[model samples]
Target: MEKCRFHEVKVSAPSKVILFGEHAVVYGMTAVAASLDLRTRMRIKPHKSRILVNFPDVGLKESWSPEQLKTLFQHKPNTEILDVNYVYLDLIHNFLKTESSDLRMASVICFLYLYSLIMDEVGIVPMEILVESEIPLGAGLGSSAALSVCLSAGLIGVLHQVQGYEKSIFEYTSSSIQKEVCGFAFLSEKILHGTPSGIDNSISTYGGMCRFEKGNLEPVRLERNLRILLINTNTFRNTKDLVERVGEKRVKYPDIVKPILESIHAISEQFLTSIQEYNQDLNEKKFYKILEDLMDTNQSLLTGLGVSHPTLDDVCRTLKKLGIVGKLTGAGGGGFALAVLPPSISGKTVLVAKDLLETKGYTCYQADIGVNGYVIEVVK
Candidate 1:
């Protein structure tokens, strides 16, 4: 338990969206996901005797002494097994009973767990962490995963300083560091969302587009970057609840639900293949058509899964009327819908679409798809 040489550490990780697959990916189906420019940033520095976290996005600002956190957990996490330590989490829940919001409490619990686990490598040292994020919370976007990845990388950056590593191994540029961050972030996500597909964290870690099946990630190469308009429904939904609902539906009618899942899986594969084969010089219009069609079918299947909300349908309809196709990007219910913006689309059309959506009480964000993932820097 030595002190770190660096004065502070900073890290950022991108949020992600399901480009083609959603709940279907959880069933060992191949799904496509990509990183969004939206990101969460975390900064960590030494404190006197308390570990503090200030996450203003959720209106959470809390502190706990090292001894206080230690007493709440049975032991440090086992790295080999990244599963949620229910015994420890239950203890944390009991300790944080005073916290009114479950979301905020879950964030604290995850911070405590990761803090203790990472601190085990360098002993408990008091620190203060502040997170500022561009990503919206509980919007099907990987805001939680981005937070987890950024927090983990920042903590690991501290470890790098303490261990006297000449170069920071926790930096996002390295593939190894990406894998490490993804693993820790996945565990943190499990604390937040009970049954995350691990797709969000994976895309957030490695960046670009990827094909995810079960827990495996295969990065996909894109000939040209895709543009998207992120439409926020401004309606919050519990991802765990929606996922569980789909699971229950499957259990009640496997014959009916299995086929939908299979169809969605096919759509994802087709989406991937279409993107890979796309050539702007040869047939640019055809590429957009293929992608738009896949999005339409995927949204339909998500509707059948009963996750799509009326507002989501409204979003799709609004975008489709403008010759732009869109679908719910995350767990449906009501989060964010992604609308593809073909290169040929005029800026005026995008503005018109945004103005129309805004009038309907929705927020829109313009960002490039498949952007870089996590990045870290140690401040001396």
Candidate 2:
């Protein structure tokens, strides 16, 4: 029998958008979201008694032997394992053993946690991982979640193939795998954002636009082609700090914020139902109206929650003035803003919007609805 020389697993992680109820979702309010084409990719390979992790785009590289990993895990005092960077060492140490200061370590732990649990059943082997992604980090795009999911799937695939086990892909489909992957992804998100709604991973795994209510995901259908402009402020916002700050406002302005949140929930339900019924009459005019209402509602609620930063407000105002419907995506404070433009607008409207945003020092990209999520490509 030919010995298995090399095995590889490739996976893509997707970006996301919040159509309605951004901050309110944290308080049990409903939110609508979709996955974007922007994605991260990861590949894994086995080495002789060694593991190498590389991020070529970022110029990061790390390698260690299995014995070194075992020694580190064994906690043999004064043992000089490989002289890896303290940051990388801390990651492996905490992930394989304890929770520590490194976010990447926490992510690795989540991946390994699921890997150890699920791999034996599927029969997988340990392998080196090379992760590369086009999704911009800290852009409210769920790049971290993509990384975690790709890792989990790659590890699981290795275990299955190496152990001579078999599981129908259909059997692992749906939220079971999603829930498992999210569990790991959220750990990393916690280290990054303090608190994440897990919406990013949820949509990225499931694909399609969805309305999440009380932890249940209901996919929504689009009636027409919707053009969205994603504006990147190039600012990184800590999700945890933003969540805490919003929490403070909830306590401070419960009366004012509560009703707004309730209203958003109602709108989201209506939006979901409308899409489910396949209302083709839902043209650009109706879509614009709905988006406008959602934008105004979201801005007010975010302002009440005190999470709206100056850049966010400016983008919203700019979109409104230009007669385009838009709102800030994700936890606000800072990150990307999304605008819904009318289809009838001049072809130059896109260029005009881009110029206007660029003039204001914001990066812009035209995004389309209905992009694929979490695709698997097999390579021999």
Q: Candidate 2's residue-wise lDDT over 1-380, tens digit each?
A: 12333456677767777877776787777888887767778877767655667776566566666555554444322212211234544545654565565544544544433443444343234467787887776567777777766765666556545554445232356556566555555544554455566677767766678787777677777555456888888777887798787677668888876776687677777667656544566555666676577667767766766777889888888877777766778888889888776677777877887898899999887776546656654356
Which 10-residue span in candidate 1 carries the lowest summed lDDT? 166-175
For candidate 2, list the clashing residue pairs, or say none. 122-160, 123-159, 123-160, 123-163, 124-158, 124-159, 193-240
Ten residues in sequence with the least summed lDDT for candidate 2: 75-84
lDDT of 1 by residue, 267-320 (tens): 999987787778335488898888888899999999999999999999999998
TM-score (all chains, Cα) for each model:
0.87, 0.79
Off by over 4 Å in 2: 1-6, 46-49, 70-91, 94-99, 104-126, 163-197, 222-225, 236-238, 277-281, 345-347
